[model samples]
Target: MAENLEPTPVDETSNRINTPFNRRNFLKYTGLTMAATAIVLTGCDDDDDDTTPMAEGSVNLGTGDVGILNYAYALEQLEAAFYTQVVANAAFSTAFPSALERSILTDIRNHEVAHREFFKAAIPAASRIPDLTPDFSAVNFSSRASVLATAKTFEDLGVAAYNGAGKLFTDTGNGLTYLTLAGKIVSVEARHAAEIRDLISNGDFAKGDSGIIAGRQIVDTNGLDVALMPLEVLQRAQPFIKQTIVATGLPTQ
Candidate 1:
């Protein structure tokens, strides 16, 4: 029987549940995106003519499962950076009226903070993949529409990432453990996705009504989809991720 599960609130101190996830083991975005995008753009232009390059050694996140864990750690870092900026510079204008909006975003920030810290704690060795720098200049932090749209994109991407990466850790020692952890976070991510989408248009929330959902093709998976290749994920995430990723022992899905 598929057990009924209540989604854990990011703001709550506990997620004590009777499903695969509970506070005990399982635990844990984006206007943050334009802000991040700006940082990346500026950083790229800063070093105009440094040709001297040093030999860069691969930061081994270990083989098999270890590598997978590190992969997640890298992603968490990106999410954390984006949300941190959103929280740091939350701009509510007169047009956007909702005290609840700020509160909800704060909850999201806390969750992202927890996810980032969790990965850092779980994989100490891989945590050194360089702190990611974000660019938010493109966003008029003064506008609520820009912030929520960017937030929605990030929330959806995060869910897709987990859905796409869940199978890669299949043979590792803590494979099941990691999957459960992913499951826990994926639910929260999905909620964020829905909320942001609703904020855009409740009728279009998680659907194809809005241009964002209908325009872009999305393949949905309950974490049972084919695992995305490391190379592919890296490519999509490259623009936002400035860190060097060294991966090994990842299986083809």
Candidate 2:
């Protein structure tokens, strides 16, 4: 039996459920959480030349902390777009007939949207990357298997992406603020990944036999989640993205 995973509002202090988790609350929470580290840092000197030649249609994700933020922004854009379509598809009802499943997907959709918007607002306009166009042409949203598989791919990829980029953040002042932010988001992403995995198979949530960890060796023998380089992550993500992403400006160390 699927769990009743409806989104419910909660008192932050008392932990009592109230109303549904809406966009306003989402933004308010994220805003308050990020207030201290919200200062937008300037691009690094190495990435000063934004005009550095690239593939005809490629967009460079500027260097330093800004570059890393753009990389995360790009992925969030992809995820938000994907979930939006999943819920809006004509066959969404049939694809996920169970009310519990529908609620889960809907909650995930709302979370992804909030994440996308948060990045957009967090990054300064001058440094933020353009809204990306996702290529979900191959996703058959009408089929539960197809949609779940795709969702699994995305969630797993998101978790690894954050894990990979966490160490790349150079702005660690104020109690490792950037890493703290990344940790917060990545924890949510990991939960989504686990939920989607369980949805696919009854008890496959934390198994290391599949997804990016198994395929890319991102998980270590000691049961630690390892990081992937920005370039590697972008390469795996390119097929789903319409715009060419240039990550050369991002930190390789």
Candidate 3:
């Protein structure tokens, strides 16, 4: 029998910072509750997948609406896996040595998992991407600096990805549900990024405005957040995951 892949209960205390907009607001606005779940982590090895691994080391994300949904799915899977591993490892406690940090990380983990599950359920099973194995060998979770730095990276990347992908949902005869949903999630990601940034360096939120690269930077000159095409986001993320991602039918413009 296949094992159940539900999220294990989180016992740590999580203090939701005072913010008018947050996950609570997100749920209220999106009509989402904390009841549903998300993605699973596959093996880190190349042979881990039940389906044939990608040829030439590249997995093609599907095209059009499904393609767009799958793209978000992939990122959420990565984030969920990274946080899951981070909190589970003994090193996390030793590294941060703060109850608040651990609690916040756990909260982030649960949120990412829900996001992952949302995408998995949103897209048809026929078009869904396989569970991905993340490569975190370079993360050095034992070190507080390393872990926070990586958290910063993933959070910022997520913000940029949603910013870029949002355009794909614009007025293409499709209803605004997906677009609205994307907006809701991106705001959450922005919050996560800000929190992580403050943990790393005070006032380090969205450096894109201070003359950083266009898509790679977290925010732009207009105080707008960064955006990256799917290919660009995937390329930047490739190093973190063992599986190679191929964007065959995703929109480019």
Q: Which number leads on lDDT? A: 2
Residue 218 of model 2 has an lDDT of 35
Model 1, runs deviating above 4 Å: 1-63, 90-96, 126-128, 171-176, 209-229, 244-252
Model 3, global lDDT: 0.67
> Across residues 1-253, which tens digit of lDDT does each residue of candidate 2 receive?
3222224322234322122335565665344354533543422233344523256657788887878988998888888777777776678899999988988887787777677766666777666777666777788989999999999888888988898898898874655366777888888888898899899998888776657655544356887765677887888889998769998788886
TM-score, predicted candidate 2 vs. hidden true structure:
0.82
Tens-digit per-residue lDDT, 160-239, candidate 1: 67776777655333223566667777777878777778887765555643332344434334523223466566655556
Better structure of 1 and 3 per lDDT: 3
Give the worst 10-residue stretch by lDDT in candidate 1: 10-19
Lowest summed lDDT window (length 10), candidate 2 = 10-19
What is the model-wide C-alpha lDDT for candidate 2? 0.72
Let me know the TM-score candidate 3 reaches against the reference structure.
0.76
Predicted model with the maximum TM-score: 2
Task: Report residue 62 deviation for candidate 2 (angstroms).
Answer: 0.8
Candidate 2 lDDT at 94 equals 95
Clash pairs, candidate 1, are 30-33, 34-136, 35-135, 35-136, 36-134, 36-135, 36-136, 37-135, 38-135, 39-135
